[model samples]
Target chain A: MYKLELKRLIKSRSTLFLAAAMLGMSVFFACVTVAGAGSMESRGYITLRGMEAIEYQRGLFAEVEGYVTTERLEEMSDYSVWARDTYGRADNMPRDVYERWISYEPILSGSCGRMSCEADEYYAERRAALARLAPSEAAIASALALNWRVDEPFYWEYGFGGSEAGVNWTLCLFALCLFCTVIAVPAFSQGYSCGADGILRCARLGRGKLARAKILAVYSVCGALYLLSAALFCAVILLTFGPDGSSAQLKLGAFVLLDMSMTGVLALCVLSGLITMLASVSFTLWLSSLLPNGVHVLALSAVMLALPSFVNAYMSYPACDWLRLLLPTGSTGLQIGMYNELAAYRFLTLGPAAIWTPFAALAVPALEAPAFALLARRAYVRHEGA
Target chain B: MNIEIQNLTKKFGKKTAVDSVSLTLTPGVWGLIGANGAGKTTLMRMLVGILTPTSGRVLCDGADTREMGEAWRDMLGYLPQSFGYYPEFSVADYLDYMAALKGLEKKAARRKIAELCEILSLTRVYKNKIKKLSGGTQRRVGIAQAMLNDPRVLILDEPTSGLDPGERVRFRNLLSEFARGRIVLISTHIVSDVEYIAAENAVMKAGRIIDAGTTAELLRAVEGRVFTARIPERELERAESAVRVVSLKNEGGGETLVRYVAEGPLLPGSDFAEPRLEDLYLWLFRDERRQDDV
Candidate 1:
């Protein structure tokens, strides 16, 4: 039975295609990791000169009225009015930048400081659900960026509209899904695509044992690739951009959350990979059993898998919004932002600006695994023969 | 134990494929000869539980095959006219899979695979992918897999269709050896192949077994309905229209030797003669509705 399953798996066109795809993706993943790590330093982000330098500059001034001196207050007041006036400006030096530059002092800002950041755990769940385009993904998702190479930190905090970091994060997700789907589509179509049904159907316990083996083998093959790609990309982004919050920063917006344990993100990858594999295999199995030709299985499964993504195209449409929530790709349609509740900003409370990441990722796979298992059995044994 | 077909009937929508067909087949090689669309494949498929008959009892050693799942199929082996398998797999891998499906334990499976491969001369190509093998070799592989379990009953449909002469003889010899104490119903359109191997020949035409018996017995039954006539080539068509023309051979100008079927003489010297298997098949198949047999 083992031999039969192995033979059936080996003979399958989908399996071979998946193997080749994994190898290529693994290499691409490694490159993405390397590039991300290598380029992390030069990425778009600004680091404050230093608290020491700013503090030294502040020391030169005299203080009064439990605030700064009257003159220092005047200087701070001058900048505050300019920021307020140009709040909606889109200039290179927009108020958004000015806002970040002149945050309040811990005691004087009237907002919570490091002490407030301590309670950030309250909003952490929502923050962890952030989804945005990773810079690496956005860098390649568009045709204008045709010459743009894949970079590191392949994933972003939010999968859709936010800051430059947020947009890239969301786009990156769309890109990765497109890539992962190539592998998943073939895995599902393998049985019919390869014409190995006879061997599978004839084996002892062929209906039951061979199917389990197939699902395992396909998942193992695809999972290995996904891991290699994800790990390599993360390494590249992290290594290239030093560990400072700016380089490969993982900030979340207010309510959309991700991993509090950090392990959640990694678990997400492994889990999604397994789910995609089962869904693909099961769908393919169903197609092979029902359709006379494997091409139909491949074409139809690809369409069915991809059709759900159209919901993300129209952001403002209410129906599209609902559709996106139901789409398998919707979770990744988020954006992440950092709400600095701290004075020096050593820590950031992460959140998705307007999306749900953790939940969507988990839900997509939950719907796919069992569906594929049933389909695989049908495909492996359904007969049109005498 | 024997499989009894009790007035078994199969209807395809409205057209009956097998109608009121009853027979008792025990352990031996039974040759089923019929023309195209004669319900040969349908009958065989039903016997092995692949196709369901409209109303029939496919008993396996007294057990209904439909009612009994694994227990019935455990003893059944079938090879359809066209069978497909994964082409990239080596013959051994495919057989192992078949073994698993047949519920054979690993040890027994290995032993059976080896034995069948040896019998079918598949040992040389046992490790080769099926796609790379020749047509005849592939057919043998199908046969080998069918026999892997040493099944109590085997239904082989057109088993020798793709085989070369030597392989066919070898297959026939092998089947005969195994059929000594097992039921093997081999379906074929060709009469000669089974004429030599079958203990009993079953003739089917228009979805019914018009005649069945030992080779000599069937030949004797059709003796008087068959005859040969030499006449002008143009007039031969007339004789053909009047009688079932089995064969035609041109002897000279405007003259042809024609063998045909008749209830009595159509021409002055058109006497009845001995009938071959082909003649019987034609006489039965010539007109399905016309059952004017003497």
Candidate 2:
């Protein structure tokens, strides 16, 4: 029965069109991000070969690296006096002269001081939640230590500030969820729309086994779409960017300050994306079974998957911010941010174990997928031909 | 197996579609004859367990349909009044899909599907999509799916509605051949389809069975009430308004032969005519319309 349903799904014109549209969107974004990659004029450290060109500047700013420590933050107060004595506050300085001056010791020291100050303020804002998450505090400190790109200069355009590849991945995953919803929401109601539900319900194995078959078919379609889209997106990014810093720490890039390996961070992104896709499809299937009209299911699913993104972007409640990140449409940056240095919030504690914000976020979909599948099955079996 | 409908009733909001009625179906071809909005489809839907009855239950072998939902369906086959099919599916694929729904094994389903297609004269168009088929051919495919499981209790609603004259005759013959031991209830607008083949005939009006018996018995009930008369062309309207005209024929210049159902002669020179199922149908509904008007 599942095989037959899958065949029917793939053969449907609507499903085919949605699948093609999803792939097209993913390819378009990935291509655009790769083609217009990093600029050679930008200042943040990127690749090993790039560091060769700026070795003289790095040696000149060696004194600022020692002052980036947490204990010496007060000693760094003399950097403003030093900047005034060297490059005076002149109105019209040449662009090249200003750029070279900023690459000196005083400017680098001031930038590191500003980063530390911002970290302290963020920690203060989330003190209560941070008190519970000791490991998260440690991870955040480690991420800060590895955050500066003082040596390496290989520009990975896939990072946050480089070419916006991370944002594209997030958008592609979200669009994939929408496409999977379009494919899944009509599985139970196809018969209803065409006047075949009565006949189907009356068939010997239809009322019971057929419901299970439809659920399996929906999940199978969702999984296939995710795998295909994710693989295509990854191939395009990796091939164009040349996987230079994959083994390097995630902090090696200009954005995404984390204490973990680059591979581990990418894995978490993929895991979160797959979980969100599954949860969204299962929840939409349940909605389909509960409602009578296909349009209602589609509309309600749109609201469910989209409303969370809008709320996450606009709403700012520190106490419940971790909970918001647990939503299926939660921000991808937030997932990385949960593991980044200075992520001091710990919204949950299980006995002696401290569940950090990232793990808490992962726990949501881990529990939601099975629960949604069970509810969808129950709704379908109990459904009458209304 | 036997199906007993005990006090079956169904309602759609303020309108009662199938009223409190009871029926016992055994192994034979039972013809259900009714006009539009006569509740034949509603009763059939209830019997098949697709629509829940407002009161009472349908029992198969002493078990309620609601209690034995899947098991009850396992022994039954039904074709709805408005039969639907996936337009993208070919005739063979549609049959195979239905076979899977009915829990038939693959080898058995293939064999059964092949036999049905051949029996229904659909072998040549087996691979053709249903949307591309003609109305008569599509109806044949509907019939093929209904008989896939060789169900013990088979119900078909308006199975001959789209068939041509020759196809209708062929389908009627096929139904007769398939109804040897299984119980088959066919509801249709074509009276002659039931007049010759069905062992028993039932007539419904306003959600209730007004009359039921063999065709000969129903004809006998309205016997001596049917008459034929000759009238002038100009007076034909007056004759029609006075009573029910079952049929009208144009004789030569200005003369007409009118076969009508009436208790007494409407013309000075009239002859008694034999009553058929059509005559009985017109008389029953015509009488009900008159009462509604009053």
> Docking category for candidate 1?
acceptable
Candidate 2, residues A192-233, lDDT tens digits: the string is 777777677778987768888888887887788778777787
Candidate 2's docking class is: medium
In DockQ terms, which candidate is top?
2
* Candidate 2 Cα RMSD (Å): 6.7
- List chain B TM-scores, each candidate: 0.84, 0.95
The alpha-carbon interface RMSD of model 2 comes to 1.3
Model 1 over residues B1-294: C-alpha lDDT tens digits? 788887778887788888878888878899998777777877876777655678867776677766766666677777767656666567887787777878888999899898888888999999898889998898898898888888888889889988988888888899889998898999886676787788887787667877788777878767788888788877876777788787889999888888887776665567666667777667666775433211
Q: What is the overall TM-score of model 1 with all chains considered together?
A: 0.70
Candidate 1 chain A minimal-lDDT segment of 10 residues:
A340-349
Residue pairs in clash, model 2:
A46-A153, A46-A154, A47-A153, A47-A154, A140-A341, A140-A342
Error of 1 at B246 (Å): 3.4
Tens digits of lDDT, candidate 1, A125-149: 2122221222222321221232123
Off by over 4 Å in 1: A11-14, A26-213, A223-250, A257-263, A315-357, A378-382, B6-22, B53-55, B206-221, B229-242, B247-258, B265-274, B288-294
